[model samples]
Target: MTEPNSKDPAPSPLGRRERLLLAAIAAALGLLLFQLRGGLQPQAPLEQMARRSLELPVALANGRPTILEFYADWCAVCRSMAPAVEAIETKHRGALDVVLLNVDNPRWAAEIERYDVNGIPQLEFFDREGQSVGRSLGGRSLAELDAIATALIAGKPLPRLAGVGSLSQLDVASTPVAGPRSHG
Candidate 1:
């Protein structure tokens, strides 16, 4: 047997082939983890709708009935109702327009005020003429949304729903009746 040289450096515990194999394993694990993470947390339906929703102005002016939803990302009701909204949008595509506006975003501040959105999940229903006919506050079930969509597509009156209110014109243009003024 040959004696070890005192001045020589010790050999590496891992050979080049072993090191390469370890690197490959680590890379595979990293890739798998990344893929798993992505697969585990898919994008929510609300996010997809928000990304694909038509702009408010365009939707209202397109001559199609519009369903404008005001929501926040953190609102539980909005999240829960997103799937139904998405379904309605899909079912009424080309005949009706569905628009989603995030209330938390400052870009929609004007719309929020115009629609008197005091709560999340406020839905404003507009006719084909771009006139707002009604609004609904709070979350709605799939059946309710579908019914509303059907009415809009058929050019009929929206179904009476809980938390829903009509936007009708007042008699503001009529001449005032004679009345005694009290200045006391």
Candidate 2:
């Protein structure tokens, strides 16, 4: 047989252009898949639970009104009330400070006592002057919490929170001990 003509080619698995196109397709598909996978993932909970909260010292010295919330991971009431409280925190933003104290942590034992927090989901309201304006307990609705905060901010009597365990001003003379150390 004669030598192969220039136009005649030996069998090859892939031509250079074919391989390059294949690689480009693979790269594009990989990127598309990556983007799709990322988009499918769920977003982290936001404004449904307190994310960043004030520490005890900052809250004590904030000069702004505060809501000291005692909660624990296992407390059902605390869990149920988280969303409502979170909404309140978001709505009030800079006008108010919400401090979260995990009762499960020993660091807040002093605060647990100071607020007379025998049960969870307790709220202790402190005014700009660091005075204990009032304390409320149990799973309060968003409306109730909002009303309470508004009243506290306005220095008005708290709107009646029916079924709330306690909602009354603290005795100025009977000051709570130095606030608990924060885990924030």
* Top candidate, metric TM-score: 1
> CA RMSD for every model?
14.7, 11.0
Per-residue lDDT of candidate 2, residues 1-184 (tens digit): 7986889777778999999999999999998987865555523222224448878668768788888887766566676677778888889888888888766555666677677766667788888878887787777888888998887777777676677643233233343334455343
lDDT score of residue 74 within candidate 2: 56
For each candidate, the alpha-carbon lDDT, in order, equals 0.79, 0.71
Per residue, candidate 1 scores C-alpha lDDT tens digits across 54-153 of 8888998999999998876667788888888988988889999999987655566667667777776788999999999888888899999999999988
Q: What overall lDDT, based on C-alpha atoms, would model 2 receive against the true structure?
A: 0.71
Q: What is the TM-score of each candidate against the true structure?
A: 0.69, 0.62
Candidate 1: where are CA atoms >4 Å away? 1-41, 164-184
The candidate scoring highest on lDDT is: 1
